[model samples]
Target: MTSFGIATAPQQVEYADVLRVWREADEVPEIEHAWLFDHLLPIAGDPDGPIFEGWTLLSALAARTRRLRLGLLVTSNRFRPPAMLAKIATTVDAVSGGRLDFGIGVGSRPSHPLARREYAAHGLPFHDTGRATDSLDEALTVIERLWTEDAPFDFHGEYVHLDGAYGNPKPARRPPIMIGGRARATLRVVAKHADLWNIPGGDLADCVARSRMLDDYCAEIGRDPAAITRSLHLGVSYDAPEATREAIDAAVAAGFSHIVLGLPAPWPGGVARWVADELVNRSPAHRGT
Candidate 1:
């Protein structure tokens, strides 16, 4: 049997109100995990537009919900230092009673002046794929060591170094590490280290092909393909007046353990409710298998 889950863009609505409603909604027995998106600025539209910090909001959600596991669909490595990110994740996992998974990626924000400005502020050199991926790999190594090692661990990487450093009060459970991206390098990293892989926007056949590719990579690396969980991000529009159950079923047939649907827009009334009902509730047994 499989399970079903939902991932949403961060609450752009009034923070307090959205938190209240999300806390309640997450209590529903059918919802397995409540996911948030990681973006320093809006991926679309104006950069000045309202956008909540993903990790901060997830930390708050950890306190507000009891059962729902919290995580980012994919966090970028360019945003913060690996040690700091590891600390934040550890804190959230402890706060959530060991129910946090750290999903990260090497992707950047969509093209926009404001987005570029924000990236510059973070000292990130956007459009440099090598730099971005190198940073991501180093960050992953640091965070994983922080989560698993008890004694002071020393890391000497090109981008990061630690000299007998220790993370106090480690996460109650070592949060699972998830890496996402369709690039060949990304897939190789997934085969080497990821607990889960999030593949974005593809048809069923595409998904199966990607899954097989990942399996082949894993086998070549002497890793078990079954050890990694596979997930998909499905963009859904509730206003379409028709559910995309066929696509969802196709994803399942391709061995996706989780399908994350993106809501068209955040409206506090019937539209949001309709999306929750028609999309997330379409299948309850296809997640976390």
Candidate 2:
């Protein structure tokens, strides 16, 4: 069966506004998960507008809401050391009663000038795509080892090196890893590591093509393609509910079983129920299921 979730980017919005939506989503059975994005500065309107840090805000949201699985839509692997991220995620898992889904990826691409500026503004190094992807591969390796390894260990990778790294009081559960990206190198990592693979939805044909490429990569690695859930992140249109429903139907038809509806800011009151009634319930995928 298909699962549906909502993403409220922590950009240009107040914290209480987000809390309200998540609390409502918690009571709605149709919405199984919720997310915030990993961005330090505004990526949308009013570049100087306030935005909350993703992981910190997520912890607060996790504590506030009881039912929804929560995490950043996809964390920027560049923002924190893998071992540090492992510790943070474990804490969230405990706080949420084991409902964390760890989503991560290489940071914003070099081409996105708006997203790129945050790196410099925050004194974070923004490497080229090749280097960034390689780093992500290494980061995931280090993170998983920290989560599962019994003893403190050291890792010497090209991008990250750790000395006596360990994660204590392991997560309530090892959160399922979800990696989001479309690059082939990223896809190879997804095939090898991710429990779920996510791509932003726009053109249906391109989305399916990327999914097929992932399948081929899985074959090369001798991993079952079906082992990884296909997740699509599609933008939600409060004004055009039918259009959003149509997009959801097309995505579900293309074999995306995990749908994350991206709700833009100035979130309407009762948005979670609004989503269930207008988008999730109205979509043919949900109706027939």
Candidate 3:
């Protein structure tokens, strides 16, 4: 059965909104998880907006929530070094008692000058698709090494090189790696790395076509397509329970097993209750992890 999670926008300044959603997730039996956008600023280009940094929020959430799994919908590979990020993920996994779903990806806003400016300020490389994918490939390798390797080793790669690479604590368990994107290179990375593939462009026919394409990529790499869970990230209204259920049903029909909804802001408590009470249980989709 299709699972449901809420992906809250960070651009909005409501600290209450983030807490509210987690609170609802705690109260609702159907919400499998909750996510945050990993952006530094509002995508709407508002510089003054209060975009709570995702990792910090995630850390606090790890300490706060008991049942809801937490993570970024797709954190950019450009922001932090993968080795450092691995430590962060491991720490969160421990704090959350092994409920972290590590979702990551290439950048989302390629043309935003503000983002580019920030990248430059941080000394992070903002390369073209090929270079970025190369870096991500290397980053995933490093991240996995840090999580899995007990002995110190050397990580020599095209983008990042480290001597005596080691990561401790190893996450209560290695969290599931979720990679999101639809680019040819991105899909290749997803096929090679992701435990859950969050497909972009969430139309039914488009999702079906893309899933088939992803299956081909998996086969090319000698992987079982079913080994990776299929997820669709979308902006579906929870303002009405019936409408939301309709959207979820459609996604499931298109072969998406996990559904992450980006709810509209101005948090509606009543709508949330509707989902908790009326919709999620009514759906035949399997209860998600």
Q: Pick the candidate with the highest TM-score.
A: 2
Which is the leading candidate under lDDT? 2
lDDT of 3 by residue, 133-183 (tens): 889989998998899988999988888998988998788777899998877
Worst 10 residues of 2 by lDDT: 165-174
Which residues of candidate 1, in runs, are more than 4 Å off? 109-117, 268-277, 280-289
Candidate 3 clashes: the total is 2
Model 3 scores a TM of 0.91
* TM-score of each predicted structure versus truth: 0.89, 0.98, 0.91
- Tens-place lDDT digits, model 1, residues 61-177: 888888877799888887878899999999999889899988999866454465567677666667576767777878888888888787998889888888987788788877888
Query: Against the unseen true structure, what C-alpha lDDT does each candidate score?
Result: 0.74, 0.92, 0.79
State how far residue 99 of model 2 sits from its true place (Å).
0.5
Q: Candidate 2 residues 1-289, lDDT tens each?
A: 8999999998888899999999999999999999899999888899999999999999999999899999887999989988889999999999899999999999898888889999999999888888888888999999888888999998998989999998898887779999999889999899989999999776889989999999999999899999999999999989999889989999999999999999988998999999999999988899777
For all predictions, the C-alpha RMSD in Å is 2.8, 0.8, 2.4
